[model samples]
Target: MTATPDIVPPTEVRMAEIVFPNHTNHMGTLFGGQALAWMDKAAFLAAARYSRRAVVTARSDQVDFKLPISVGQMVETVGRIVEVGRSSMKVEVELIAEDLHTGERKLCTRGHFVMIALDENHHPTAVPALPADIAGP
Candidate 1:
């Protein structure tokens, strides 16, 4: 759906995925590449939902995997637009791994992804400004 000027960051996109065995590596932890893919997807969805246009991942920076995400945990990715440019949206995507039985939550990774909105012709296009009061995660 198209987003209007009143759209807030938190309302853009929030996704949760279970860390199944298939998502883990032989080390029994979530794979780094998979985590990055999820983060990028979260950012793309947030940007597209807000801009109501096709969007592409431009760049990701400062990705830090603070802790290992174990299998059988719940991975929640919260994406919010941090800033707006002519056609680029800077989004902060935070990954939180939660233990279902123990109720323990840990910050796994946090990264900033820049997504560029595209027009029907696939050219860069403008996007609405993020609400001033909305804070990044």
Candidate 2:
């Protein structure tokens, strides 16, 4: 069985965002758990795009909190399907905070999410190869 490549091209990355609010905070900054949740969601979306099937988080690797996201800031999550196996995908996801008015960007957190493709019965299923152009150099 051939393993998927370790890297995926930047173009394959999918980006999404949500505005921060008081309720999304714990200490005047976006909560770490909230960031993790969004990262997982974005990773799942990226993995599903290639798997063409339902995917669920099987693991998270080395989640690092590098900066703080403040209220009214837009939290943008970028996710990419980096590696694939018989039934699993490794998605690299980054969380960034953007100034709403100025559009400035800062990376807040980054992590790798391992997702498994699921069949109709919710059992693990195989994932197809990513297109050549979308794959890494």
Candidate 3:
């Protein structure tokens, strides 16, 4: 049997807020799809910051939600390049929701997203070497 490779740690962490009314379920919780959409966005931003090129999401691993995020929560999303190839990068993502009022935070979900950098012609393009600090960890 082929062994699954280990997931590498993130080289950087990016965070953003979960504004009110973003909680769509009427259960005082953010929607799962919304969380996913934002996580993917965050991953792309981090990858672009490191790669210095336009990047697109090629794949998103199954997302596992461990908790819910409510309105007024400060959601922090972190991404790391777990793997890199000629023109592709696999980023590990984690989302945490913090209750601003109580200062309580909960891990909402974790997943992996694969992104590919693109050239002006929209063709796959090579990514620059990860920053020395962002290299394989």
Report model 3's TM-score to 2 decimal places: 0.81
Clashes of 2: 0
| Cand. 3 Cα-lDDT | 0.81
Steric clash pairs (candidate 2): none
lDDT of 3 by residue, 54-129 (tens): 9999999888988877777888998878778888888889998887888887788999999998999999999755
Tens digit per residue, CA lDDT, model 1, 58-103: 9998999999999999999989888888899988999999999999
Task: Specify the poorest-scoring 10-residue window by lDDT in model 3.
Answer: 6-15
Per-model TM-score versus the true fold: 0.89, 0.82, 0.81
Residue-level lDDT for 121 in candidate 3: 97
What does each candidate score in C-alpha RMSD?
3.8, 6.4, 9.1
Cα lDDT for residue 87, candidate 3: 86
Evaluated at residue 41, the lDDT of candidate 2 is 86
Look at candidate 3 and give me any clashing residue pairs: 10-80
Q: Write the per-residue lDDT of candidate 2 for residues 55-126, one digit (tens) a residue.
A: 899999999999888878887788888777899988989988889899999988999999999999999988
Model 2: how far residue 112 lies from native, Å: 0.3
